[model samples]
Target: MKPRFYDLSMPLSEKTAPFPLDTPFSRVETMRMEDGDACNVTVITMSVHVGTHVDAPYHYDEQGLRIDEVALERYIGKANVFTVYPREVDGIPIITADDVRELSISAERVLLHTETYPEYAAFHANFASIEPDAIDVLAERGVRLIGVDVPSVDKATSKTLPAHKRCREREILILENLRLEHVPDGDYELIALPLRIAGGDASPVRAVLRMYAETKDMT
Candidate 1:
């Protein structure tokens, strides 16, 4: 039997919590089946960066690529899930180059699994973040995508986000707000798909992974 795929996204709802200070996600009914409507439908109005989402280069760079401008291959490929338990990675103090060097990263998609699960399920303060140095390392290494388990890559209080800038400048895709507790650090086939919103800076993504089984034929 083939292994099952695990979903790594938070449920979106009217009661669903978003990052601190961000507007709460809302779903309003544009057409309802209960009101003798032909179909049940609703229009969603919320920040693209609200939940599990991907940030295009245009998120930070004015001249960078938008959500629709990105290629399909950027979101799907072999990815590495690296787990990190940083007590505090807010502000300038965050995932460093040395921390990244320790991980055996060879995949184009580097998904960082910070053990900040459950704790970040609801509204909370201070999610684990990535430092500029780590971003520098990723950019230099030709990493195509950088994903994390938290909302933003930098601290919530950051005014100038060098980490976002580094990746944006290099055209590296950004995937955030993933549930990485169930996934371990290893090689896997990553499938992260984002909405093709025209000129959108970001879009929520449904991220998952497919674990490969060892084949006896390899020997």
Candidate 2:
């Protein structure tokens, strides 16, 4: 049977809202056929952390590997999607270690559906984020990668970014800003390759998931 594919990436455009103080996506038309140019050409500019993207260890650690240095295998493989609704703690929604422990982690790559930052064109600062203890739980379970539906793994107002730092220390790759609202909770093959940007701390990715009939019950 042919596998079904689901796009788990945010639609990147000029209106695609970026994180606070980060660069928004923009495009410039250098040549237009309507303007008598031979062909249409455009240039795009945006922060690597914009939209659906993967964060390299270097994003939080000075001695961490760059985006280009990380192995590609870490981004592509079988993954599990789980929906989690975190409760507010001190006016901030957080996914705690208990929340993670409740889920049956069957894959090396785990994508959490928080549905907090649902709108791609709207930047919501109060979106939910994973806690450092949750990161430790995933790492202890041998999870190599952690993906989320929000722009960050830590709270928007975080100064220390404990979750990001814990992930770096655990050597767990991170994929953030994923559009996982439509994806069901199950196992699927994930493909979210980052660009080979030299010395980059992060890179935008076209994340997707493949559903197979035979593997639906495997998890």
Q: Which candidate leads the pack in lDDT?
A: 2
Among these predictions, the greatest TM-score belongs to 2
- Superpose all Cα atoms of candidate 2 onto the true structure and report the RMSD in Å to 1 decimal: 2.6
Worst 10 residues of 2 by lDDT: 210-219
Writing each residue's lDDT as its tens digit, candidate 2 over 68-184 gives 999999998889999998989988889999999998998899999988887889898888988889999999999999999999999998999999999988889999999988888
Q: Any residue pairs clashing in model 1, and if so which?
A: none
Question: Compared with the true structure, what per-residue lDDT tens digits does model 1 show for residues 1-219?
Answer: 555666888777766677767776898998888999999898887788877889888888888888988998888878888887564532333577778867777788899987654554476545667777777787777688998888788776777877788777666788988888777678777888888899999888888887734321333
- Residue 26 displacement (Å), model 1: 1.1
